[model samples]
Target: MKLNSIISERWSPVAFSKKVPDDDTIQLLFRAASRAPSSFNAQPWKFIYGIKDVDTMYGYLFDLINDSNQKWVKTAPMLALGIVETVPPGRTSLNRFAWYDTGMSVGNLLAQATDMGLYVHQMGGYDHEKARKVLNLSNVHEPAAMIAIGYKGDPDQLPREIAERENKRQGRKSVSEFVTKNPF
Candidate 1:
């Protein structure tokens, strides 16, 4: 089946190069994410990112990752946390679709990064409360996911098990399994 180059080419790589992406490229990613549609245009997504060569940000974020993820994610040149505001500014009720909107924003970010020859690996394996404290996030914000972004690196550099998985081609469920034309 045919697919758009940006969509087809995007894959989450466990190994990443050490080269930090420039500030302009990073901002471009946020710009793409900002364009995603949201419930009532609330745009609840927010990101906290750190480049490897920068200050202590990378280390602090890295430490919050679970042990399994920490093994490989440290090699990534950039790290970010996706956050969603449970209650949007100037609103009284909870934003029911906040997490869904945040995921859409991340989708845009992934596509944009792929178009720029970068790869992104997003993980749910992190300490949420720890992230909240470290980032000084208010009670209104929820930690959604952690993202490791950088250029793809040599799979051989990864640990044996991870390398094997990374080198293998991934598969997806057939469309028939998930798509439906009428109510079941």
Candidate 2:
């Protein structure tokens, strides 16, 4: 079976164009994410975003990213931090699925981006503790990932090794390799 073009074509590229998506477009991305299902409809995901040359938060988010990622991320036009609300409002117990739910939301965001001819790269190599301190993340909130968003850029502009890596096709495990029948 063939996969949908959007899904098949989706990839995380380190080389991003300088073009900045408009405010409406950015908001639309979040709207798509908002449509994702969540535990008890708690909608635990929260995103903090900033556009390059337009918002100071962009720099702060960029600074939080590790040096290696920073090299190519600098070309992206926007950056965002994905955060999850660990506890539901008025509740003390932990929401075990908060992280998973947040990831679902981000998945929706990525699909929307691909449909709109944009690219998104989610990064785990960021200063998590510093992010908590700098962003003033509350006790109930925890950082999940940092995202770089923009159009695809010229690979030639990236460092040689990174450019090569960016040009490589993304590979995934076959369904049969990970799937199992009931009563396994």
lDDT of each: 0.91, 0.94
Q: Write the per-residue lDDT of candidate 2 for residues 1-184, one digit (tens) a residue.
A: 8989988889999899889999889999999999999989889999999999999999999999999999889899999999999999999999999999999999999999999999999999999999999999999999999999999999889889888888688778998988988656
lDDT of 1 by residue, 1-184 (tens): 7899999888888888777888899999999999999999999999988888785888888999999999889789999999999998987889999999999999999999999999999999999999999899998999999999999888778889987768666899999999999898
Q: Model 1's lDDT to the true fold?
A: 0.91
Residue 142, candidate 2: alpha-carbon lDDT: 99
What is model 1's C-alpha RMSD? 1.3
Give the Å error, residue 168, model 1: 2.0
| Regions of model 1 farther than 4 Å from truth | none
Give the top-scoring candidate (lDDT). 2
Residue 138 in candidate 1, Cα distance off native in Å: 1.6
**lDDT, model 1, position 84:** 94
Per-candidate TM vs. native? Answer: 0.95, 0.96
